[model samples]
Target: MTAFILVAGAHTGGWVWRQVAAGLRDSGARAYEVTLTGMDGGGGAAEPGVDLQTHIEELVRLIDRIEGQDVVLVGHCYGIHPVRGAADRRPGRISRIVHVDVGVPEDGDPALKLVPDQTDRERVLSLARENGAGTLPAPTVQEWQRWGSVAGLPDDALARLTEQAVPQPLPTLTQPLRLSGAVAEVPTTGVLCTANGSSIAVVEAMVGLGDPAFQALADPRVTFFELETGHWPMLSAPRELVNVLLRAAAGKGHRVAAVREQPTHLRPFLMDVEERPRERTGRVDLHLPDADGPRPAVVFVHGGPVPAGARPTPRDWPAFVGYAQYAANLGAVGVTVDHRLHELTAYGRAADDIAEAIELVRADPRVDGERVALWFVSAGGLLAADWLAAPPSWLRCVAASYPILAPLPGWGLAGGRFRPAAAVRGAGRLPIVLTRVGLERPEIAVTVEEFVSAAADCGAALEVIDVPLGHHGFETVDPTDASRDAVRRAVRSVLGHLRVGTD
Candidate 1:
């Protein structure tokens, strides 16, 4: 039987999950409402000397006991600390993680570090020191009602909660969560309380913009669900919360890019192509059109130069595969490859990886060996600038989207810095098409526009599609109607260019 481990938030114990755990058990699953050492009762002798490490070890010990069985670990509110720490230590033990109305922590993040209300935080800490012997006490019943934590609860339920809630260990709130990327591979679901009417994109964009603490929400592996209730869904909407957790456990809420989901019009034309037949540079899923003769192939390079030693996930495959499938459906061999990012500071090896991928894709019997095009996204466009400067006999055109076209501080390269603007001066006459998001990233938008202007000055037949309403990484992060339309038009234009010689 599968199991669900329910971890409660600050000033809470396993008692908070009583209804939720019972609901899970009634639904044919084993459930455990975990209480950290000091948070077990209203007031206990074991309430002293507890820290974040103690809480993390408690969950880890539970996982070790339940080894060899499928488990879904859930974290609510401040419980995200222990759950994330345990997940990082034993990622394989848990099949999925459900974050119920809580924020995920980044490596070395402590509680309240991301909180903006300094006065409120200080008040809570002062109250803990004064009343609970260095422990942060639970909010009063009236305070819970006023703060909306008990918004939809009945009077008796509210009273029970306030009576049972215990003081949280102060160390747990102050200790940093130590972690590595191991837990990053774990699939996470964010069950958001949307009674405030906040969408996932809006919330994530706000948090990701400046705060490194809320930055973990941007991880592609995270799938989101919104419930129309206040903060404490376990108390306010347990049944609905359970349903969402079950869906997440069954992997139903994710928006993954699988090859079979291609549109009907594109289905018959699409065929999966492996970009590298015998290399460890990572595989790219190529979707090629089914044509009678060899067709022009477009080698698609995706945006990321991921940090050193990070494992790639299926979330990383979607946007590029989507574009490749779109290109394939329109009569071209669309190749998408995950080129190697040599080091965090350099990308010369990425160039070699792309060159190898292009050659591998071009050599395929279904692809016309003499005709090829280049499609690059984000930083990939800058990496492909070398090829753009020295056009091959077979290379027809190049298309780039929201690309980082110039090198700035921090984005170091091998041998020398990334200077795409300079590279464009020598790019003889290769026709280039660029799609610029209106809500471009502050770091590279100006440089990209300057590069485009420089390329046009150097006599390259350049076309710029300006999507003023689109934001940086909109193709993947926030694919608006306008952004999708822009992509369709760009793909058609590039395919048209590639078909010139063959037609």
Candidate 2:
């Protein structure tokens, strides 16, 4: 299967990739537009806190589930910074790099810190602050003129851009790119955008400074191209951009234009007092949305339930970090805390630990005390289901994946997991479940079966989906069909259920 993963620049989301995606499909390639975190409108905005690593995690997640062995990655504007890191994570996963109106000029260092000293990028922060902690519209042509002349955009084109502009989350501009080993090894090409040459900080500066890193891709693994067009290629020149992308997909380089839309966090974090503690320490990384409106918070429990504060080996794998970032991107505070032997030795005692954490977060004004959700991975799902049994008003939704029906009469197991026979009698909304068992692991078959039985007995709405994947670990990465369907529904359902709590 041929896959094309397209991403937008700052001030835009995956929605902008729609028409171009359609065009690509009509031309016979499977294409997907990705809306990176901090871009979408409903999710709100970042705090003085959002950074580059956060943005990269979101993009890598989109790259994870792509069906083809390797995809042609197309990133525009600052998006190139993050996708390059993603390419670093999986050397062969992305076969080609298409930088629309973006170019490496040089490898120098990771692009994370390659920022402009001018006000062009900083203006977004002022806009977001004025708008109350959310994305603001991109500068209009009239607005762009305030900085410098946009060398080439003509009349009608420049006029139409103003109404369509949206504000960008400040982090995308401020965050510097973080490089992984995969990035250093991947083959890449840059499609330098110069239509509005005078307005581009990098392009206009190139006359004297040369490439940012000085012919960074001079090694055997890189190439370059220059395109003359306005920044919004999808809208300004969809056909031109599509044709450019098609060539890149075919292993060449080109530039394109497009249009798009664009995207938070604090804490009452100290309340979870562990009395019957295990030999482990827990760290809760809560990302509070920035606003007075009632927002939701998510508790992230990894699938393997690894030790607390231990980050996955990001440099070695493509699936690390994105899990927790998912919740943060959605304007929900994310608490990826660690529970030790308590979660393993005593199930009930372990669960209350999470409950206390919820109440602690509710102490914050940003979270609507009544509209919080809990999101868990494989084994974590079992624990979350059990905890939600007597959930507080704030614990509004539950999203569990590949959960066990019962290990020991509703027990969560590190070993022999068969769906628990437990029942959650709470009136909380139905859970969104994503489960997949290895074709060879029959217990995987019963994983969802057991969850279904418990949901029916519990009297809650349950959206359960099964997949043909060989292992239970697929949901954490970019998801396949069965897994994505379940996760997408679960995310939507959890958001909806949280609303119910607010009511």
lDDT of each: 0.70, 0.53
11-44 in candidate 2: lDDT tens per residue? 5667667778898998898898887665555433
TM-score (C-alpha) between model 2 and the true structure: 0.42
Most lDDT-accurate candidate: 1
Candidate 1 minimal-lDDT segment of 10 residues: 262-271
**Span of 10 residues, lowest total lDDT, candidate 2:** 261-270
Query: What is the TM-score of each predicted model, taking all chains together?
Result: 0.48, 0.42
| Leading candidate by TM-score | 1
Enumerate clash totals for all models, in the order shown. Answer: 0, 34
The regions of model 1 sitting more than 4 angstroms off are 42-46, 114-116, 124-133, 145-149, 201-220, 254-503
Cα RMSD to the true fold for all candidates: 15.0, 24.6
